[model samples]
Target: MSDIPQERRVLTAIPGPKSVELQARRTAAVAAGVGSTLPVFTARAGGGIIEDVDGNRLIDFGSGIAVTSVGASAEAVVRRASAQLADFTHTCFMVTPYEGYVEVCERLAELTPGDHAKKSALFNSGAEAVENAVKIARAYTKRTAVVVFDHGYHGRTNLTMALTAKNMPYKQGFGPFAPEVYRVPVAYGYRWPTGPENAGAEASAQAIDEITKQIGAENVAAIIIEPVLGEGGFIEPAKGFLPAIARFAKDNGIVFVADEIQSGFCRTGQWFACEDEGIVPDLITTAKGIAGGLPLSAVTGRAEIMDAAHSGGLGGTYGGNPVACAGALGAIETMRELDLNARARRIEEVMKGRLEEMRAKLPNGAVIGDVRGRGAMIAIELVKPGTKDPDAAATAALAKACHAEGLLVLTCGTYGNVLRFLPPLVIGEDLLNEGLDILERAFATL
Candidate 1:
C-alpha cells in the first residue's frame, strides 16, 4: 500500500501561502505558454492522491494526463528505477547500449498488438516516436502522404502539429506544417449526422474516399490514428471503423499506425485499444503510461516495415534511458501482478454507472451532451440544457468547481467542451466513489 492516504483533504486555500510564493517564482522563471490546470504545486503524490505544498490532498483524476497508470510512485516502478539509477543513469544507448533498453524493446515487441515478427525503436517522448513512425512508413512504402483524422491530437512538434486537427491552442500560428498530411473524418458517434448505427461504415467510407481522391491511395505512405481519440475528447471511433481503415491500408500497401500514446497499457481496459477491435496495424506508437511517469516512447511494428530504415538511420541521445526502461519493466510487471486490465473494467462499470445515474437525475439531461469512453479513460461532453451545441463555459466551470474542492479534473476537446477522467489504475473503490461524489457536487453547483 502507499504511504499517502487515499482520501481528499483540503488545508488552507488550494494554492496556500507556500504555493503562492512558488507560483510567483515560477512565473518569473517559466515561460508564459506553459500552463497548469491548478495553480497549486505538487509536493508529493502516490496511489490516488496528490499532496500539494499546502498539504491539500487532491484526488488524482488526471493521472498527470494519463502518464502514470500504475500510480505516481508505484512500489515496483520506484524500486526498479532506483536500482538502475544507483548503478548508472545514462550511458547513452546510441554510444554504449544497455541491457535495459534491449529488454524494453523486447517487452514492447511481445506486448504490442500482433503476432507477426516485430521490432521496436525507443524515443524519449510520444511526439518523437510518432515522427519516427512516419519516417519508417515513408521509407518502407517509398511514398510521402500521411493521413490523420479530424479532432485527433498527436503531439506538439512541427510534424505532429500537421497531423493534429485542432487549431486554436495546438495549431494557431504554428505553420506551415509538414506537407502531404491529409485530414479525414473519424467516427464520432454522438455527432454523427446519419446516426450512430451508420457512423462506422460511413465515416470509414468518407475517409477512404478523401484519401484515394485528394491524396492518391498509391501516394499515401501511412494512415495514422488513435483507436480512441485522446486530447480530441475521449471519442472512441465507431465500431467497424478501425477494421475498415486497416483493410484499406493493407490492400493499398499503406502502413497503418495506431498512436496509442494516451489509450495504451491498461488505461482503456485493454493493453492496447486496437485489441478491442482486433485490428492490428503495421506500426504502433506508444508512450505516456508505458514508463510509469518516466519519459519514454516506442515505435513497434512488423520486422520488415521497421527494418526498412537503414542501419544507424534511427536513434537519439536519450532514446531509451536505462532508468526509464527499468521503470517500464516494472510497470508491466505491476500490471500483470495486479491485473489492472480487470481493475480498469471494474472502474468503467462503477463510474459509468454513477455518471449515467447522474445524467438521469439531472433536471435536463442535455447538460451532459454525451458520456463516452472505455474503462478508466472516460469523459463527459457538456452542453447547454436541451441543446446539442457545446457549452465550453459549463465545462470550464465544472472543472473549476472540482478543483476548488480538492478534486483535480481536466478539460479537453476540439471545441474545449470535454471533461476527461484518467484516474490512476490503482485507485481504491471507496476513494473512487468519493471522487465521483465530489464531481456530482460540482455538477450540482454548475
Candidate 2:
C-alpha cells in the first residue's frame, strides 16, 4: 500500500501557482526541445495518482508515458533500489561486473519471448537498445539494410530517426540520418489503403514486395517492428501480419526484431506483444516498463546472434546501473506478486467496455473514429465527424480538456489524432472508472 491517497483531487487550477513558478524556472533551465504533456509539475506520484506542486492530485492515465507499470512508487522497487544505493551507486558494469546487472540479464533471458538459449545486453534508453539490436543483427547477418514500417517510431537517435516513419516532431529538422534503412507500409487497420479487413494480407504482401524490389531481401540485416505501435497511435498491426513478416524474415535469414520498448512487460496483456501472435523474434528491444520508472533498456535475443559482436564490441558506461538493475528486479517481483498481467487484462476489459459504450452514445460517434489496442495500452483515434479524415484538432482539444479536469491523458499518432491511455496496472478499479468518466465528460465538452 502506498502512503499517497488513491484519488483525484484538484485544490487549485491545473497548473496552480507553484507549478506556474516551477514552469517558469523549467522554461529557463530546460532545453527548448524538451516537452511535457501537462504544464502541472509533479511533486510526487504513487499508485494511480500524481500529486502536483499545487496539491492537485491528478488521475495518471499516462503512467509517465508507460514507464511505470508497477506504479511510480512501488514499495519493493523503492526498497530494493534504496538498498542498492546505500551500498554503492556506480561501479560501471563495463569496469567492475556487478551481480545486479547479471541478474537483470538473467531475468530478461527468462522473461523475453524465446526459449532458445537467450542472452541480453542492457542499455540506458530504448534508442540505445534499438541501436544495439541493429548492430547485433548486422553483425550476425553480415548485411546492411534494415526494414521498418509505416508510422513506426523507434527512437530519436540518428539511426532510429531514420527507422522511424513520422516526420513533423521527430524528424523535421534533424537530417542526414543513418543510411540503408527502408520503410514499408504497416497494417494500420484504420487507414489502410485497401481496407481494414484486407490489411493483414495486403500490407504483408506489399511490404515484402517493396523489400524484394527496393532492397534485396538477401542484403537486409533485420526487419524491426513494434508488435503494437507506440507513438504511432498504439495501433496493433492486423492479425496474421506479424506472423507473415516473421516467416519472411526467417526464410530470408533476416533478423526479426520486435521493438517492444513501449509495449513490453505486461503492458499489452502479455510480457511481450509478439507473444500475442506467437511470433518469436530473433532480437527483442524492451524498456519503459522494465525498471519501475528507472532508465533501463535491453536487447534480448538468441545467444548465437547476440555473440556475433566482438568480445568488446557492445557496452556503455551507465548500461544496467546497479540501482536501476535492482529496481528492475524489484519490478519483476512486484509484477509476479500482483499478477499485473491479469490486472492489465482486467483494465482492458473495463476500459474497452467503457470506451465502447461511450463511443456508441457520444453525439458524433464518427468523430471518435477507431478504438483499438490491447490490455492497458489502449487508444482512440479521432476523426472528422462524417469522414475518416484525421481530427488532430479534436484530439488536442480533448487531451487539453482531460488535463484541465485533473486527468492525465496523452495524444499521439503520425497525424496527431490519437488519445492514448496507459494507467498504472495497480490503479484501483474506482480510479480507473473515474478517469474514464472524466474522459467521457471531456469528449462531451468537445
Candidate 3:
C-alpha cells in the first residue's frame, strides 16, 4: 500500500504551485476536449486517499471514475503485473494464444451472473467489450435494431455513442452515429412524473409500446441498459423496470444486455447491479473495476450467445494483454480475500445513512432534490429550490467547493445536476466519514 496517510492533509492550496504548473503544461500539450474534473495531478494513492504533486492528500470519492475498486495500486495486482511484465510483454493473443487470457475468460465466466455454461471474451476497455457484445447479439438474433434507455451511458465508441443518450459532451460533434439504434425511457424513480411506485410499470409499458409501434420487437437485435446508470448519473432503474424489459426482450427473441461497466465487481453490493433484481441478461458487459487499475473488460454471457460470432470474427491486438490478465487474477484474489462485496454493502449503510441524514436536515425545497443509488454508487440530484427542475449550476458550485476542501467529488446526470460518490470499496470508515463531512460543508456553502 502507498505510504500516504489515510487522512485528508492539505499542505497548501488544493491546486498548489506544482499542480498549477502541471495544469499550465497540460493546457499546451493536451486537447481542450479531453477534459479533467480536477486540475491537480496525483503522485500516489491508496486506501481512500490521493496524494497530489503538491503533497496535499485528498479523500478520493470518485475512485478514478470507478476504475480502482481494489485501490489504485493494489498489492496483489501490482505483484502479478510486475511478474508478467518481466516474463514477456506481448505476443498478441490472436497470433499466439496464451494461458493467462484463457484463465481470465474462465474467471469471468464463473463470476458473471448465470449458471448455464457461460463463456467470456476479454478486451482492452469497456467500449470494446460493449461493441463486441452488440456484434454477438446481432449475429445471434439475426437483427439490427438496438434499444437503449434515455439516460444510459455505454461508452464513447461510435456504436456506444449511439447507445449513450447524452449529447452535449459525448456525442455533440461525433455525429453520423451507427444506424438502427433506438432510444426509450428509463424509470428514474425520483424524476418520474407519476411517482416512483408506478414509474417501473409506466416506463416499461411506454418502452414496449414504442418498440411495438416503431422498431417492432421482431427487428430489435438487443436491449441494452445499465442497472445503475454511470455518467448519466448513478440512476438505478425503478424496481420491476429491468425485469419487465428483460421479459419483453426474451419473449421477442431480443438479446438482453446489462451494461455493468460501472456497477459490476462488487461496486453495487452485489457482484453486478443486475443481480439486485435477479435479472439474468443474455450478455453482460464489464470493465472499470475489473482489473484494479489496468485496462481490461469482458463480455460474459450464455455459451450459445457468446459463441455466436464466427471463430475469426471478433478480437483485437491488445484485447487480452497478458499483464492485464495477471492483474485481473490478482484483483479477483484481493476481492475474495477482502470480501469486498460485503464491504460495498457496508459502504452503502454508511454513505446512504449520512446522505439521507443530510437530506433530512436540509429544509424543504433545498437544492438536493433526491438522494439515490445502490451500494457505493450513490448520488444526490440538485434541483431548483421550489421546483424539480435541475440545478446544474448549484451542482457545479458544490462540487468545486468540495474540491477546494480536499474532498474529491464528481458530477453527472443528463442535466449535469447530480453529485455522485464512488469511493473505493476498501476505503476506511473514518476517512469516508471525514470526506462526507467535507461534502456536508460544501453543500452548506451552496
Candidate 4:
C-alpha cells in the first residue's frame, strides 16, 4: 500500500556519505541526551524496510521501538489523519470537545479486557497515561504508596523513573524522584534466583509479603506491572505470577494497574498481555501501537475508579488532540480488518521456532541464555555461555553486526544483555525471513 518498495537494498555503506554529513549537523543541533540505535537518518519507511539518507534500505526489526505495528505508512491511518488535519488540528479537548475523543474512549472500553463498565482518558504519551492512572488510583483509595516490580520500566519522567528499576541509562544521575513508590520482585523466569519452575509461586509470594510487611497494603493506592516487561528484556512474568498479584491487589482493595504500553495493541498476540492469564486489571495504561505511530496514550479502567478524578483534575493541553484521535480510530479499523492479533501469533510461531533452532545449533562456547516473549515481541538474553551471568558486550556486538548488514535491531534489559526484535506486523513474510536470515548470519559469525 506504500509507495516505497518493500525489499531491502544497500547501495552504500550503512552510514554513507550523506548520512555522515547529517550526523554531524545532528550532533551540533540536537541535545546530547537524545540517543539513537541506528542513526543513518531515515528518508522513508514502509512495510519492513527503512530507506536511509545513504540510499541503503535497512530491514526494520525495531519498528520504532514497537510503535508502528500497523506499518508506519498505513493507508487508513494516513487518510484519516490527513482528513482530520484538513478540518482542524488544535482546539484542545477541554476547550472544544470533539466526537473523535469520545469515540476513541468508547472503542477502548470495548477492546480492553473485562466486560464490566469501563471509562478512559487520553494522554500524549505512555508516561502521562501511567501518571494519570496512579493519580486516579490514589484519589479513589485515598492512599499514597504505589508498588512496582523489579526490572520494570515505566517511563523517563520523575515519578516513572522512580517506578523503574534499572539504573545505568534510565536513572543514573537523574534522581530526587517522587517518593512513596516501592519496588518488589518480578517473576523473571530465566534469572530467578531459586529456579525457573519455582519462579511463579515464590516470586509472587515474596512480592506480596514485602508489600504487606513493608508498605502495608492498606496504605497502597495501586500495584502496577507490565504483564510482559518491555525495556526490562521483554521479560514475561512467569506463569501464575500475574494472576497471583492481581488476586492480591483485589483482596486488599488496591488498584491493580497493568502497564500495557509496550505490550498492548496486539503486540503480544492479544489486545493486552494481561489477557494471556485472564487477569483483568482495575486500570490499564496503553500507548506505542495505539495510533499507527501517532502519539496517543490512554488510561482505561473501571468506570467507578476512573470517575474518581475530579473533572478538572485530569487533562493536558494536548491530550487526545482531534487529529491523534482520528489516527487512533483508523488504527483500530486497520487492526480489525487485518486481524493483526493473528498476524502477531503467526510471527511468534515463525520467529520463536527459528530462534529455538538457532539456539540448538550454537557452538560449544556460544552464549544465548534464554529465548522468550510472545507474538511480535521476542528477545534473546545473552549470558556467559555456561553461567547465567549477563554478557552485555555480546549483546552489543550482535546488534552492531546486524546493523552493519543493514538489519536494524535493538538491545534492551536492566543489565543490557537482551537482543530484542519488533518487526512491523504488516511486514511481508519474505522480508521477515530475510531479516531473520541476516540475524542468523550475524549469530553464526559471533
Best by the lDDT measure = 2
lDDT against true structure, model 4: 0.93
Q: Using lDDT as the measure, what is the rank order of every candidate, best first? A: 2, 1, 4, 3
Candidate 3 — which residues are off by over 4 angstroms?
A: 363-365
Q: Cα lDDT of model 1 overall?
A: 0.93
All candidates: TM-score? 0.99, 0.99, 0.98, 0.99
Please provide, for model 2 over 1-446, each residue's C-alpha lDDT reduced to its tens digit, 9 standing for 90 to 100: 36889989989988899999999999999998998888898889999999998899999999999999999999999999999999999998888999999999999999988689999999999999999999999999999999999999999999999999999899999998999999998899988877899999999999999999999999999999999999999999999899999999999999999999999999998998999989989999999999999999999999999999998799999999999999999999999999999999999999999999989998876688898999999999999988988999999999999888999999999899999999999999999999999999988888
* Residue 82 displacement in candidate 2 (angstroms): 0.3
* Cα lDDT of model 3 by residue, 1-446, tens digit: 56678988989988999999999999999989899999989999997999999999999999999989999889999999999999999999999988999998898888888888998888988999999999999999899999999998989999999999999899998899999999999998998999999999999999999999999889999999999989988888889999999999999999999999999999988889999999999999998999999999999999999999999798999989999999999999999999999999999899989988888896642777888888889899999987889999999998999999899999999999999999999999999999999988877767
Q: Model 2: residues >4 Å from true position, as ranges? A: none
TM-score of 3: 0.98
Query: Against the true structure, what is every candidate's RMSD?
Result: 0.8, 0.8, 1.0, 0.9
Clashing pairs in 2: none
The digit string of per-residue lDDT tens for model 4 on 295-331 reads: 9999999999999999799999999989999999998
* 137-160: candidate 1 lDDT, tens digit per residue: 999999999999998999999999
- By TM-score, how accurate is candidate 2? 0.99
lDDT of each: 0.93, 0.94, 0.91, 0.93
User: Model 4 misses residue 173 by how many Å?
Assistant: 1.3
In model 4, the clashing pairs are none
